[model samples]
Target: MEFIILVASSFTKLLDPVVLAYVIAGFIIGTIFSAIPGLTATLALALLLPLTYSLDVTIALMACASIYMAGMCGGSITATTINIPGAPSSMMTALDGYPLQKQGKGALALGHAAIGSMAGGAIGAMLLIGLAPFIAEASLLVQTTGKFSLLAFAMVVIVIAQRGKVIKAAMAACIGLMLATIGLDAMEPVTRFTFGFSSLTAGIDLMPVIIGTFAISEILMQAGAAKEDRKMTEAMSAVKIRRRDFIPPLSSIREIGLACYIKSSLIGYSVGTLPGAGGSMGSFLAYVETVRTSPNPESYGKGNPKGIAASESANNAVCGGALVPMLTFGIPGDPITAIMLGVLVINGIQPGPQLMAGQADLIAPVLASLLFSAVVLIPLTLFLLGPYFIKIVSIRKDILYGSIALLAVVGSYVATYSTFQMMMALVLGVLAYYMRKNDFPVVTMLLGFILGPNLEEFLRRSLALSNGNPMTFFTSLDSLFFVILTLVFVYFLAIKKPLQKPTGAAQSA
Candidate 1:
C-alpha cells in the first residue's frame, strides 16, 4: 500500500508541464544522438551532465532516465535502415535488420524491434522495482572483504569477456587503474602522483576522462576515416518510407512468441545486474541464444524477425537492469550508470542501502520516469515520427563530426571551468583513439578506473580490521563465497572456454 501511494505521488509530481517537457525533449534529443553512428547514449548523458547543475534534482533525473531509455531503442532505427549500427549494442540487430531492409521488409523489422523494446523495457522496470529492496537487504551481510572480493570478481569477468583479447584487455585495465591512482591515495592522506602541480593533487576528474575517451576519440577516428570514405549521398541512397510500412502484422508478432521476449528480457536484466556487463553483451548473448534455440535457425542471419526482436528487447531491457546496482549498491554496471551516479552525488544524494530505505521520494520518481518513458516510446517512434527517422542516416558526416567535436570541447571545460580539464580531455582522447584502434577494449579500462578506488579502499579496510592477516578473507562465509565465485568465473571465462577449441580440434582429427 505504501509503495502504491509513493508511485502515485511520483506520477503526480512528474505530470507538471515543465517536467513533462524536459522528458519529451530529452527523449527526442537522445533519439537523434543514438540514431547517428559514432554518437552513443553515454556521450549524450556526459554532455548533458553539466546542464543538470541548474535544474531541480527530480527534473534532471527524469530527463536522464527518459533519455537513457530512448537512446537504447534509437540504435535500431539506423541498424535496420542502413548497414551501420548506431550503438555497439545494436550490432546483433544489424545482422538481421539490414537483410530485412534488402528484402523490402524494413517496416516489419522496425515493428518487431519497437515491440520487443517496449516489452523488454517494461519487464525490466518491474524486475528492478521488485528486486532492489531485497538486494539491498542482502547487501547488509557483506563485509569489507566480501565487497573487495566482489569487485575483483567483476574486474576479472570484464577482462575475460574480451574473448581472444584478454591480454590486451588486462593491459588496458591496468592503465585505467594507473590513471585512477593519480588522485590522493585511498588509504593515506598523502598524495602519490601529483607530479609537483597543485591541481594534480585533486586528482583526475571522471568527466574529462569519459568525454575524452568516448566523444573526442570518436571524432578523431571519424576524421581519419573521412579522408578515404565516399560521401554519404554516394554510398547509399535514401528509401521512401510510408506510414503504412511502420506497422507489423499480427501474424508476425505471434510467430515470435511470448516466451522469447520474456526470456530475452530476463537475460538482459540479469546481465545488467553484473558490474561491467553492459547492453552490448546482453543483446549479443540473447541474440545468440535465441538463434541456437530457434527451430528455423537457418533463417537467423537471413532476414529473420526473431533475431531483431531478441536483440532489441535485450538491449533496451538493460537500461532498467543497469540501475539496480547503481541505486542500491553504489556500484554502476556500465558507463552510463556511472554518469548517473555522478548526477545523484551532485544532487547530494548518496547511494547505498541507506538510499533505498530513506530516499523513496527521489528514487520513486526516477522509477516512474523509466516506466513512463517505455510507454511513451511506442507512439513517439512508430506513429508520430517513424518516416522521419529513416532520413536521419542521410546527415553529412563532416557536419556531424564537427558539431560533436565542438560539444566535447565545451562540455569538458564546462564540467570543471578549468583549462586543465580541457587539456586532460584532449590527452585522454588521443590515448583512447590509439587504444580503440588497437582493439584494447577501452570500456574495460573505464570499468577499472571507476571501480579501482573502491576495490583498494575495501581491501585496505578489511586488512586493517583483521590485523593484516592474509587469511581474513576466508574467515567470513560471505567473503569465502565471493572468492570461490571469482575463481569459478575466471576458470570458465579465461581457461576452460579457451581450451575447448583445441580439444574439439583434436577429436575431429
Candidate 2:
C-alpha cells in the first residue's frame, strides 16, 4: 500500500507543466542533435549535464531520458535521407532505409520507423517497471571473468555477422584490435604501439576515425560516381502509410506488435544492461535475430518493412533499458549512460540501493516522468516532424559533401587540435574506403576497436584474482556459458554453406 501511494504520488507529480516542457524540449533538441553528423547522444547529454545542476532532480532525469530516446529515433533521419548514419545504432537501418529512400519510399520507411520506435520504447519502459529486480539481480552476478567471456563471444558474433568475405572480416577485426593497442597497455604501464610521439600517448579518439571512415569515405566514393548517378531530381512528395502498410493484413497488430516489442525490448535490455554494450549492439543483435527468424529471411537487405522495424525498435528500446543499471547501480551501462551517471554524481545523487532507499521520492518521480515522455513523443513525431524530414533528399550532393568534409575536419581537430589526428583520420579514411570496396565490414572492425582494451583489462583482473591460474577464467558459470556459446557459433559457421553473393538488392553500393 505504501509503494502504491509512492508511485501514484509520483505519477501525479509527473503531470506538472514545467517538467513536461523540459522533457519535450529534450526530445526536440535530441532529435536535432542526433540528426547531424559528428554529434552523438553521449556528447549531447554531456553538454546538457551541467545545465541540469540548477534544476530539480526530476527535471534532470526527464531531460536525460527524453534526449536518450529522441537521439535513437533521430538517427533514422540521416540514415534515410543521406545514406550516412547519425548514430552507431542507425548503421543497421542504413542496410535497408537508404535503399528504400533511393527507390522513393522514404516517407513510408520513416513511418515504419516511427511506429516501431514508439512500440519499442513502451516495451522497454514496461520491462523497467516489471523486471527491475530481476535485471538488478542478474547484473550483480556478472564479474570480471564473466565480462571477458561475454566480450569474447561478442567479438565472435560480430565477425560472423559481417556481410562479405570471412577472411576480409577477420582482417578488419585484426586492424581494429591493432588500433586499440596503440595506447598504454591496459595492465602494464609500458606503451605498446605509440612511437614516442606525445600525441600518440593519448591514442586516437574513435569518433573522429569513425566519422572519417563512414562520412568522408562516402564523399570520396560519390566523387568517383558518374554525374548522372549523382543527380537528385526526385521531388519530395508525401507517401501515404495506410494502416495496412505497417500492420500487414496477414499479421495482426496484436501478433506483430507483441513479437517486435518483446524481442526488441529483451534484446535492448540484455545488451543495454551490460556494462559496455550500447544501442548499436542491441540494434545489431535484434536485426540478426529478426532475419534468422523471419519467414522470408532473404528480404532483410531489400526494402523489407520488418527488417527496418526490428532495427529501429531495438535501438530506441535501449534508452530506457540502459538507464536501469545506471540509476539502480552506480555503474554506467553504455556511453550515454556514462554521461548521465556523471550528471547524477555532480548533482549529489549517488546511485545504488542506498540512494534508492534514501532518494525514493526523487527516483520515483523521474521514472514516472520518463513514461510520460514516451506518451508525449508519439504525437509530436507522427504529426509534426515526420512529414518535414522527407524533403531532405532534395538537398544537393555537392553542397552536402562539402559540409560533411568541413564537419569531419572540425570534429577531428576538436578532440586534441593536433595535425597528427587529422592526418590519422585521413589515413584511416583511405584504408576504410579500400576495405569497403573489397567487401570487408567496417562495423566488425569498430567492434574490435571498442572492445579490445576492455577485454585486456578484464582478462588481467580475472587472472590476478585467480593467482595466475589460466583455468580460473572458466570457473564462473557465466564465463563457461559464453565459451560454449562461442564454440557453438563457430561450429555453425564452419558447417554452414558458403555465402553466395546476391547480385541484386543485397549488394551494397
Candidate 3:
C-alpha cells in the first residue's frame, strides 16, 4: 500500500507547473524531431543531454520519457500525410496510411494511430511498473558467470538481429568493443590502450559518442538528402488536413477491436524485453500478427485503420519495455535507452538491481510521464496540431539541420569543456555516416560499447575463478541456460527469419 501511494504521489508531482511544462516542451520537440525523416527521438535526446546537466534528475527523466513516447507516435504524422515514414518503425504504418491519404482518410488514419499509441503506451508503462521490481529481484539472483553469458547473449542477439547483415553488425560491434578499451583498465590503475595521450587517461566521454553517432551523423546524412526531401516539401504545400477529422469515430474503433490493441501491446512489450529487438521489430511483429489473425487480411495495406493501430501501438509501447534492461541491469535494450542510460549516469545514478528499491521516488515519475504522455498527449497533440501537419513537413531543411549541427557540436563541448572531445564527436560522426551508408547497424555498435565493460569484467572474473577453465560456462546452470538461450535466439532471429515469407507491408515495400 505504501509503495502504491508513493507511486501515485510521484505521478501527482507531474501536475506541478514546472515539471509539466518541461514534459510538454520535450514532447513537442521530440515529436517534431521524429516527424522529420532522418531525425529521431534518439537525436533529440542526444542534443538535449547537455541541458540535463543543469536540470533536476527527476525532471530530466520525466522529459525523456515524454520525448520517447512522442517520438514513437509522432512518426505516424508523416507516414499518413506524405507516404514517407518519419521513423523506421512507421514503415508498416505508411503502407496503409498513404493509401488512406489517397482516399481522403489520412486524418482518420492518424487518429487511429494516436488511439493505438495511447492504448499500447499506457499498458506498457503499467506493465513496467508492475513487473520491474520482480525482474530486478530476479536479476540479482544471476551470478557472475550468468551475467557474462547474459551480456554475451545480448551482444550476439544484437549482432544477429540485423537480419541479413550479420557480418557488418559483428564488425561494428567489434569496433565498439575495441573503442571501449581505450580508457583506464577497469581493474588496475594502468591504462593499456591510451596510445600515449594525456587526454586518453579519462577515456572517451559518452556525450561525444552519442552526439556524434545520432546527432552529428544525422546532420551529415540529411545535408545530402535535402534534395530528395524537396519534392516532398513541395507536395506538402498542396496538401491540407482538418484537425477535427483527427478524432476516430466509434465505428472505426469498433472495427479495430480492443483485443487487437491488447495483443499488439503485449507483443510489443514482449519484444521490447528482448535486447536489440527495439521498436521497429515490435511494430513489425505486432503488425504481422494482426494481419495473420484478421478476418480481412487483404484490407491491411489498403487503408485499414487496424494496420495503423497495430503499428503505432506496438512501437510506442516499446519505450516502456526497452527501459527494463537499462534500469535493472545497466544494459540498454535499444539505442534511445542507451542514451537514456547516459542521462541517468550523468545524474550520478548507477543502475543495477538495487536501483528500483533505492530510487523508486525518482523512477515513478518517469514511468508516470510515459503513461501520461501516451494517454493524454498523443491525442491532444493530434487534435491540436493535425490540421497543421503540412506546416511542420514544410520546414526548411537548411535551418532545421543547421540548428541540430550547432547543438551537437556545442553539446559535445559542454560535456567536459574540451575541444578535443568536440573534435572526437565530429570524427565519430564521420565514421557513423560512412558506416550507415554501407548499411552497418550503428545501434549494435553503441550497444556493444555500452555493454562491453560489464561483459569484459564478468568474463574475466568468471575465468579467473575457474582457473581459466573454458568449460566452467557449461558447468554452471545459469550460464548454460543463456548459452542455450543464445543458440535458440541464433536459430530463430538469424536462421529461421530469412526463410519466412515477407509480410503484407514487407512485400509491398
Instruction: List residue ranges in candidate 3 displaced over 4 A.
Output: 1-4, 226-228, 499-504, 507-509
Kindly list the per-residue Cα lDDT of model 2 for residues 1-509, writing each as its tens digit. 34335645777765778887888888776776676544565555644554665688677886788888888878876776566677777777777777777786766666666667776776776667656655555655767887778677767766664434667777887888889889777666888778887677766666455555655555566677765432223322433223323323334333355686678767876767654457877787788787778788777777776766788888877877877766665545555665565456556666553555566676666556556555568546645765554444334557765766776665556545667767887888787778877778765665566667767777889889999888876778878887998788677554466434223223432
Off by over 4 Å in 1: 1-5, 227-236, 498-509
lDDT of 1 at 408: 85
Q: Model 2 misses residue 458 by how many Å? A: 2.7
In candidate 3, what are the lDDT values of residues 322-375, reduced to their tens digit? 888877877888888888888888888987667877888888888888888999
Model 2 residue 332 CA deviation in Å? 11
Write the number of the candidate with greater TM-score, choosing between 1 and 2: 1
lDDT of 1 by residue, 110-215 (tens): 8788888888888888788777777777877777888887778778887887888989989988988889889678667899788898888878887788888888
Clashes of each: 0, 0, 0
Candidate 1 backbone collisions, by pair: none
**Native-vs-model 1 lDDT?**
0.80
| Candidate 3 TM-score over all chains jointly | 0.97
What shift in Å separates residue 91 of candidate 3 from its native position after superposition?
Answer: 0.8
Q: Best candidate, TM-score-wise?
A: 3
- Give each model a TM-score: 0.92, 0.63, 0.97
Kindly indicate the candidate among 1 and 3 with the higher TM-score. 3
lDDT of 2: 0.66
